[model samples]
Target chain A: MLDKTLIGRESESTLVEVERGAIRRLADAVGDANPVHTDEAAARSAGFASLAAPLTFPGVLAQNERFRHSLDLGTRSLLLGEASIEYGRPIVAGDRLTVKTKVADVQERAGTSGATDVLILETEGRGAEGEFVFRTRETYILRRG
Target chain B: MLLARQLYFEAVKVGDELPPLVKPPVDRSQVARFCGATGDYGPLHVDEPFARNAGFPSVLVPGMLAMGFLGELVTDWLRGARVRRFGARFVKIVWPGDVVTVRGRVADRRFEAGGRYAVDIEVWGENQRGELVVRGAVTAQLFYSGDDETRQRGGQPPLVVTPAEEEERLAKLSRSTAPARPAVGTRPAAAPAKVQPAKPAAVPQKGAPPVPVQAKVPPRPEPKPVAKPAPKAPVKKAPAKKAPAPKSVPKKAAPKTKAGKRR
Candidate 1:
């Protein structure tokens, strides 16, 4: 089994500034026709300060390499087994955010195909004002070597 | 505000089912668009031959894209329901022509701390062939409208969408937006541009931040045309002319594809 001591270990924090174009691209990418995600006026009408991010927009921030290496999952044949995100509030363009990730849990189990390591990663995002914005938990299945 | 109606916690029953959301079929453009938006160009999603080499018949949709679909499903259903928690696991690879259907039901409801009422939902997505592609649960806070206790506690109702209002909004939006997209693989004049050029990755070298200047000059778009010729196996006039760059890049950038093919 892979080293279990990595559990509770934290990765180097990553900081990202939310951009309007990035928000629009993400919305268009998903084929979501929601105007609030692409148009500032529509977002204002919807009671947001600017084009609010789609619920899953934070996934972009989670795509950093440090988090993957925190669990030493960079080289493993891994599949995203489960993902969960809890939002404290809507994210908007120009919101500078910081994400800190930690290896939450690890367990070994036998599946139909073979033995695997289920690695759980927990990421917490905070806005520029240092208030919590969202938290994401992703479970990756690592095929045992 | 955006929702014409407000969905109150009191009106939701534990067994209530949501209206099914059917998305346009997965297409190459959509896949390419997602890659540009998220900056995830994991070859398996965009490179057709690479995908086939990896044992998939064609390009596979990113698992996160399916989760995004489910997120859209929830927001469209609840109008403005605050998604407190959302999760899903991909069950199967979604291909280019699959029409995805998102189905869900209210699993449970409870009043949480701070006077927030939360609803637990069971959601699943299926393909045109009725194969399950993803399944998961979502927990959202449904504002309890018309509750004196909530109002006294300074709580406000969340926006909820009605079928009629949603239909009208979508119709109006559709008219204002560009024409509907054509079916996948039936190429239209507006196939999305080739996937964005690879950003000079930010790999730290010897604890020093790689200079950002190199990334400013975008890679040429011409590489796409050349790369397509070598992979298809049928349309080879002469391999010598087009064989230099694409072959080199694919061998280096997409080692997994090559390794998979070798196995």
Candidate 2:
């Protein structure tokens, strides 16, 4: 198997722009049905700059190479059952964020179904001001079939 | 007022909710700002006309943006350790002006190959309607408290090696390091403003250098560049931090539990 440590790494830092249309589009996909998510007029009335994204916008900030850790732990299967997030601050449109992320850890567990591998990655999205705009700990559970 | 709370491995237990991470509602201006700043101009992010044509109730939130909120939660809880492995799946869309709160609870703790206790973490995004659009999990390396007691005040403490001393140690080991490899081409073009004035294509590397992908050297508008400037126009890129090994290094075993390391 290829070395998991080699792939369980990060690339150079890149900057990302948060556009408004994306927030509304993602809202539509989730069926949020909230006027705040889609209605520009509604946002204007609510005292906002433009349409905003739901609070989960930061979930996709940090990503890794696929199957980067399959051979690291001794598990062939990883299954995901539940996920949750707690917002420190609301996500606004037009925010320039710098996300620094890294491979946090990898583990194996014995379950009723079988052995599973869990990979944890962390990311911090800082705005221009260096304030804590957003942060997240993303996870991947690769189950051994 | 915001007070900082550090979640140590010894004090953590499964099902314990780290303090609630509250995010205000999203707005159009901020959404567009997020689009510009994040560089994820998927039309669906800011193009309202295109969105209506595509058939949807309203514009949707970027999945990665919502995840960024989760990243903030981890930083506060872990007190600045790198979150090793993070992954999430987009189940639902989040729109502007919707209040999405981040919430997570410890799931389990187990030792990795090196006796390092890996904390299983799960997080999600909830809208005003309390709907969850995204879910994820993570493992964090933390500094525990026991070590603090031993090293309290003035004593031979762990992590006490001065930077100069560490530099000396690293210098001694540098003899075994390999030579620099040739640069690789192929960085995306639409670059940000450069931090300093320099040749459009070249960058000087210091210690632990970065990939050439980070060095395309965005062409600044001015011909005469400033000296020793910070990299200008940093877009919000989620590159993993720390040393990026190649595809052949051996996987690390569960780290051994030291006296007070909390990761």
How well does chain B match by TM-score in each candidate?
A: 0.56, 0.53
Residue runs of model 2 more than 4 Å from their true location after superposition? A1-145, B1-6, B146-263
**Poorly placed runs, candidate 1 (over 4 Å):** A66-76, A143-145, B1-3, B47-54, B146-263
Among all candidates shown, the one with the greatest lDDT: 1
Q: What are the interface RMSDs of all the models?
A: 9.4, 14.0
Q: Would you estimate the TM-scores of all the predictions?
A: 0.66, 0.40
RMSD (CA, angstroms), candidate 2 = 23.8
List lDDT for all candidates, in order: 0.61, 0.46
**What is the DockQ score, from 0 to 1, of model 1?**
0.33
